[model samples]
Target: MTLTAIGLAIAATFAGWVASLGPLPIGEAREVSTTIVDRHGKLLRAYAMADGRWRLPVHAATEVDPTYLKLLFAYEDHRFRSHAGVDPLALGRAAVQLATRGHIVSGGSTITMQLARLMEPRRQRSIHAKLRQMVRAIEIEHDMTKDQILDLYLTLAPYGGNLEGIRAASIAYFGKEPKRLTLSEAALLVALPQSPENRRLDRYPNAARAARDRVLDRMVEDGVVSDADAAAAKAVSVPKLRKPMPILAPHSSDAAMSSVKNKPVVALTLDAPLQQSLETLAHDRAIALGPNISVAILAVDNASGEVLARVGSPDYFDDRRAGQVDMTRAVRSPGSTLKPFIYGMAFEDGFVHPESLIDDRPIRFGSYAPENFDMTFQGTVPVRKALQMSLNVPAVALLDRVGASRLSSRLKQAGADLVLPKDETPGLAMGLGGVGITLQDLVQLYSGLARLGNVRPLREIESRRGEEREPERLLDQVAAWQVGNVLLGTPPPENGVHNRIAFKTGTSYGYRDAWSIGFDGRMTIGVWVGRPDGAPVPGIAGRTAAAPILFDAFARTGKLPSTLPKPPRGTLIASNAKLPLPLRRYRPLGELVRTDGERAPHIQFPIDGSRIDASGGDGMSAAMPVKVAGGVLPITMLVNGVSVGELDNRRQRLVDSPGPGFARLTVIDAKGAADTVVIRIQ
Candidate 1:
């Protein structure tokens, strides 16, 4: 046969043998550690691969430093961009050196070849392995772009032990990302991957430093770095100890991962800086508050309902504190934290006003008689004061009037999981501390108050978009405003600024749980401090324990407290005497019973001190409603002290709204009983 035909046959045989190796394992190369980041892409936490290796994903164009890439190419494969899997000149030089010295001097492998070796690791080096790597390198170069091949190398290259990739090494050694690296840091990372195990920074500092210096020397020789820069880089010492991977928001990270299984990156709605600060605050405060006590904090954006920071526990590894338990979701007695909702319900029902007088004396319902936290009660106080002080009897009385089941239902409508004791229907005692709730739910409810009655569900994962639902109502706009205004006046803890945040404090029975939930126009934060085992901590009241933390959390948000929403229309801004007769005092249905033959007449509608929409857009006065209760038949009505007309058989009348400005309303019955109210008609 001719020599040309023989050569063609040999080449055909070699191509067939190479094709028998099957497809490259690109799927295996794509596997990476799952990382959880904040909304801004800041790392919150990371989990190792199934094989217990820290191999974080990388993007060559954005994540890696340019200097490191330059140094790496100059030292590892100078002709990397120009070569097709291998350099013939470099291989020829290596062959010549090996023949003269009877030893292997260099591998002459390009970056693509190194990537092939990493993707398909061999237990022992041999001619067969080298041949396989060469074939795989050529296949990879044909299939991938230069940048993609660099990205794969960045992700899969080993540093030492279980840490793979430049990111893992940078975080483990320098506690930072690889976006910006010092000259020495870049050099150290470039060198470690060549002989990762023998030159581990933590295990063999001397070997690691020597390898790093050698890389720097090569950069100097190649004119990639000046001699002066190389000298400074070599002067710096290598890291001697590896840091534990970032575990900032462990509980939040775990939750994100579970929700997004198999995702390479899980992004959440958390703020990393705020989260770290709050975690530090919790940890330091927990230590100071005695042992076995853990603190949980949850902050949410009032407008979007996105969770800004969540410290599930003070320390996630503390066995005594049961820190692994996410206390933010743990159900515990809410104590007085539910008082604001009770007041909100009462306001919504129109039976009470903030200025209405309510008795705070000891009260009973069936077998339950609730008392104040201090066991003493003021005889009578304004409803506003009752809520601001978190008085027990007044709240329970209001709850009784508004039905416990309704309050629970309203809260559930707002997306709060209100857990009543087993088989015990929601009752009056729930107003104080009979029900269980979680810090996360509490924060969500307060966020509703900040949003003026409409609540958006709290969201943690950024990618998990919630389906649009009907707007959840915690209270009507006016009622929610009233509740928030009352809470805004709640006395601040010592050293705390007043009226900056609308907050309520609660201590469960026996001091088992201490909670403080607060909100402003922009955000809401809830704090829980207690034993994870539900064991009581004496003297651990909400005001002293959790309220301070809540205040500190707001301060750490790095912005001024946003003001609450403006009062909506129809809101009654009034004093006790100026309120409508029925609204002047809040009396439970039972206490409202009258034994006298007939009660005096009183105005029931057009709440006093309210702004009446008397505009009469059609150019005439709008008929103002005049409703009367407890009056004899055919009562007389007067507007601005001038007689308007007599009431109908229903004892109700419509009077022309005298004009704009203030007006006096009077109702007089046959028995000479009369009632008066002053209001602004506009």
Candidate 2:
């Protein structure tokens, strides 16, 4: 110790001793709560006050783990129950050791003194230090309950590194809850009060491990844990070292820190594990896509519109290649991902429905006429099908039907960031996502669908220093589900899986940029892989490559509930967009013939000769029944080529069905022929 620092310590000690009878000082400094907690309130990170504040209820003393509390007592002050804040014996021993050996005073201060020091101002030690420490210690003993003091200590102690308190510190190191921690882990955390930075688990894993083990051994010797338990804990894998994205993990992010800095923290909807999972996935993707092109992966919890993880770049510290661009928050062109927002507005405007049809053939909007990726045409189709294939012409066509001016206004209303040239770029083609947007915006926009159309901005930081806002609805829940239907399904252009996912994909002009944005009930993820300079990265296409990543990232982020945040009023149909209730009636040709016997004679065969039936199991069809030979014999059929029918042993009656030759016909002849016979028996 320096002479001045030593002198200051001695003077402070005497001052503390003299001041013990009066008001003891309490450090009111707001130490960071470094507790790492899971969505379920389990601790994940172990250690510190730096960037810590997670949920710590005012009455959270009950949830405080006994083992962790005991550890604070054992390490900070072994005789906490009897001490009057300052442990004279330990202090005297510390004094001897320091004067002789030089270095840390070891475990001499009582928990009260440590708490006093924590809440007090930092200063070089002096003779007055002992008096100051003693006084503050007495004040703490007088003012707080053992549990309250314990809670205060746990909430204030500094674990090595930026971790300040137990809450933040818990997840910071061990990747589990403090209450759930093994004796060894709790002891390791206790050891951290001396120096978190000097004992970073990641930077100095060996030292941390040794210190951690020794703490465990101490606990075992003190009867805190059985030798067998200590041995078992040691045998367990060294719980994860550092938080997943410490550089950006909820533990390290400015946003996460600000959320809990001022008050008892609450559990945030953000998932560190999910975020870490996405970051790893994104880094690998950035590497695979090659150098010069950086990729950002963003995952949003659909139910709450909370963004779980955002991998800003390939590697945050890697300056040359993956500079600090948080693609999730940074504004960028979302390409087609922005299309759904327009759809949401249109849905609100009552211009379309899931089954509403539109023309996909190109039509000029001023100087710009949006072309399909293949430059092909699919004359006319429903809005639902257009969205299914992400057909450009149909989307622009629907936008025109909704009117661009209203569309723009609605986008602003829905919280889309509209930063574009006054008149350039988006002609009628803007609906096809010619308009630019960022991944964050896309996630938020999809959050409308994800959260039932209540599109709130994806906030990186919490609203209040200590409070959280109740989630608001942005889009109609029904419409959001409808939109969800559009984003996910069989990976299109043909068939993949009816694998239920709802998302939108976009490939920009010249194929330079490709984006896929959407969400299921559980998560919303947006992937943008392209050149930052506006030039194209070769071979990047939305469905072909980008969508897969979106798919992978979304699937990997964990499944969540599909509750839709309430949608803004009027955006959804109160009853599912007036969809047909699908009231289907089947006439055996016999029923129809019985009702309209006069017309029954117009049939090529008698209605009585045929047994009636219908297909399209969901009652999506009106019916048509046919009769062939006498005794309701077998019928020849060729439906699109494949034939199917029966009247032999399998069936013996004139078959009454919606179709005898439609390719999807349910039945044919004994040869299983798709009926070529297109006659109506009725």
Best candidate, lDDT = 1
Cα error of candidate 2 at position 354, Å: 5.4
lDDT, candidate 1, 119-234, per-residue tens: 99998988788888889999999999988999999999999999999999999999999999999999999989989999998789999999899888878877899999999988
Q: Clash number for every model?
A: 0, 100
lDDT of 2 by residue, 396-490 (tens): 76566445765565566677775665667445555655566777766777766766657665654334223434454455555566676555553
List where candidate 2 sits over 4 angstroms from the true fold. Answer: 1-25, 28-30, 33-79, 86-109, 113-135, 151-245, 248-252, 256-267, 301-303, 321-323, 340-359, 380-383, 422-426, 450-496, 560-682
TM-score on alpha carbons, each prediction: 0.88, 0.61
Q: How far is 625's C-alpha from truth in model 2 (Å)?
A: 48
Query: Against the unseen true structure, what C-alpha lDDT does each candidate score?
Result: 0.87, 0.59
Candidate 1 has an lDDT of 0.87
